[model samples]
Target: MNSKSRVVVWSTGGVGSIAIDAIRHRPDLELVGVWVHSADKVGRDAGELAGGTALGIAATDDAEALIGLRPDCVVYAASGPERDAGAVPDYLRLLGEGINVVSTSSTSLVYPPSYFHPEWRKQLESAAEAGGASFYASGVFPGFGSDQLALLLATQSKTIRTLTVREIALNDHYPVADVMMDGMGFGRPLEFEPMLSTPGFIEMAWSAPIQLIAKALGAQVLQIRGSLDRRVTDRDLEVAFGTIAAGTCGAVCTRAAGVVDGREAIVVEHIIRMARDVAPDWKTSDSDATYQVDIDGDPDIHCSLTLGDAEGHGAGRGAMAATAMRVVNAVPYVVDAAPGLLSSLDLPITLPRNVLE
Candidate 1:
């Protein structure tokens, strides 16, 4: 009981809330503090903010207050559009304070070697080394779906020809209007360029996983490319976020391909639909959240992973829970690892521990 790692939830937002509950359920973790952005959440119990009973761990806007607790790890889940502008400084602060940070915030940090900001990486490295702490980045899509699972599936092969990880998600139940409607351009016209369609956006958000995979396989990435294909709704469609009017985009197929040895050998493809049947021509499956990994080699292999709630619905919600737990599960490993910016490749298998019901 005395040896359990002390944990601080950096934000009680989307994944942060789930992370708190996950930490509370873990026998090896003791939740000591919660940091929230919203002023209204300042005095609320962490459990109430996480949509549960009172946990007695009140939320605070003061980051330094949380730091005063001297937690072993901080689940930095605060996220936004300006990720590079926001998450980096927070990571530096936590790492410099000798606190291990496991986050789902920055996709660039998924594999820091390929990060766009070399200078920032250097600072992060220096901070971690100075404070003797480790920083890790991971989450559902850019994380497990795009990187680890495909890399694991490749172990079944002797010689690899091509590897691909595809996310076929029915986003109808995903309630984030900003991400689905504005960011992904689901309800926007073809002329509209949503956040995901912008040039260099996909590469910025997903290239890390490609580079990670390419590096792990002893392959060099000469170029990373991105492309987008959209499907318009023939009729008005209603979704969890809102309605997609007829003639607007209802689904999208976004691909980030890593060119290795003059071929797109490593690829991360996302086929997100406003509804299950929106993109019938695509690999729309029965499940809401399904990840498909395809490897072509001496012996080909294909795998499908799905996530769902207990009631068999809200696959998106289940994905949120999974994302939180993934990083929560990694807290112990990150704390135990050598002080540096650690990637999934750096750590042993971070299995779920002491959470079995």
Candidate 2:
């Protein structure tokens, strides 16, 4: 709605690259500038990083320079340690400059701020208010998969007693390395911290999801519980993506339970691991990957949902790009949204018309 119709991309990593490919193919959205933290990538063509023909959008390490341009929006895909620290400043700068933003920086931030760093959340809120813009964080799994699944289940009946969502992903090697290597309990034994302590890693990163579903059901959440379990191996082996390096075989399961008005009404579970020739469990291990969701309500009513096969990133680059694409695509609508700490629940689920296939 700014009429500028230009969008900037920050970073060009796994998710960032995907977002670039998605943006490059769109006619309505212009790829104006690219921000890179690594000095090596600066001055490089953004199109090359995205595996496309050069588009003349050179990468720069300067955020202030990009902010000065005042693009309509920025799609943030930057992550890692820098995300919590340096990324915040960039976000604030863009917001303070009155540029609308949509990002996957902290995918779950679009939800409630209870589980997140309070200081960071407040900073974002302040930036948005000062600049008269909107911000949202989104991703493929939590933003839509488990969180939305629960919300959809709650709608089937008026006497819903309990809600449960279970996801089985035996092909997500990237997340395993991410959680094990960079996650809180990596070097230390799992017993030391437990899954509950690292809900930010294992379970959905956003606390707003539980709160959102509870509110939608006309109830207030009283408590939340989480647990994590990992399947270990002694020898390294190569899987679909790459080598597992022995010692890290099997799966990681994270479970979160939410109590509404002193009663357990929500249970969210996620399982990510390497599944090759055989299923981890004897009963089900015939396929490379399988995703399913089960929601139970009063009278044992259950809705079984399953996602069809998706190679590599599970929906591939398109699905990965969709996470950021949908967010940036929603900038125009979000700018017109009511101010305050907004929730993904507050945004529309449909993709905008301008985005491409």
Candidate 3:
């Protein structure tokens, strides 16, 4: 019998927890180690840390120890909203050690060459080559479920004029405080400038998707533009993260548009809120949270995708699970790929393995 691929999961946040669950249950993969960011998490069972049953493998904050295990691949689920300075070096160290990496941390890394700084791209590529390993970044939005999937659906189009992908999420139940309050400026005063408001911020964040879609459609992007708007809460709201006082920022609407020949040929739009009633004017899906893609051309196509377990798991939780699964399912393919940075465009179809059993 073929030996299972040894894997390690980095971090234990929302997405990380899902990766751990998938790895532990997969018959073709073996959970070898887990890297934790918090000292308190050290020595705890990996499964327990991820909100599951004990898996016997203890989590550790010691990077050296985790690297020493020589895991075949690392499922990196660390946060990257503010572009954590330590992320690059950490990824380099792991890649340089010859461990293939699949991550959801840096969304831009989904198609690094297209959006990343040339110097940083070269550095990561060099590290991957030196270690004889590969690196791939992915997530539900910037990864397969949005731009990539939209492109796939566009294959039937005889001619295409424009493409737009929109994510409308009711984020009250999303538990990441930093992402909601800090990164997105949620619960802040209306005048406060959040990271997403900075000029070119949305463009930079959604560049990969824009560029990927353009490339797939064989369109030349001349420029990219960004826009942002927010709404205030009329009453105090309680969410998984914390309380949001009335008069604070409650809803956010942002867009990044890729222009081709003076037209907005491709666009990525996000409509997020702490309460459903906050942004009544903004367009939304019938479901709690939905990703919709519209292709305008010969035989225009429209697709809507909803995540979450309606039976129990909230849409927020389901979105997190989908993000994790997107990276986890790509592990084997990424491990077998040639050493270098890879994008969704380059990877073969990666489907979940041993999932039903």
Best by TM-score: 1
Residue-level lDDT for 279 in candidate 3: 81
Q: TM-score of each candidate? A: 0.95, 0.83, 0.94
Better of 1 and 2 by TM-score: 1
Write one digit per residue (lDDT tens) for candidate 1, span 1-357: 135899999888879989988888878999999999889889999999998888998899998889899999999889776876888898899899999999988867889898889999999999999999999998878889888898888887898888999988887776778888778898999899888888898887787899999888999998889999999988888887878899999999999989987888998899988766776998877778888899988789999988895443678778888888879999888989999998889988789788667
- How much is 228 displaced in model 2, in angstroms? 1.8
Please tell me which predicted candidate would have the highest lDDT against the true structure: 1
Tens-place lDDT per residue, model 3, 1-357, is 235789999999889998998898898899999999889999999999889999999999999998999998999988755553667888899999999999988888887768557777888889998999999888888786666789888988998788889998887877778888878988899888888887778888888889888887778887899999899999999998999999999999999999998999899998997877888989866566788899899999999888776542278778888889888988888888888999888888788788874
Clashing pairs in 2: 235-246, 236-245, 236-246, 279-285
lDDT of 2 by residue, 198-247 (tens): 54443445355666677666777767776767655455656544455544
**How would the candidate models be sorted by lDDT, starting from the highest?**
1, 3, 2
The weakest ten consecutive residues by lDDT in model 2 span 282-291
Off by over 4 Å in 2: 1-4, 175-178, 181-206, 234-236, 239-249, 276-291, 298-319, 354-357
**Model 3, C-alpha of 80: deviation from truth (Å):** 5.9
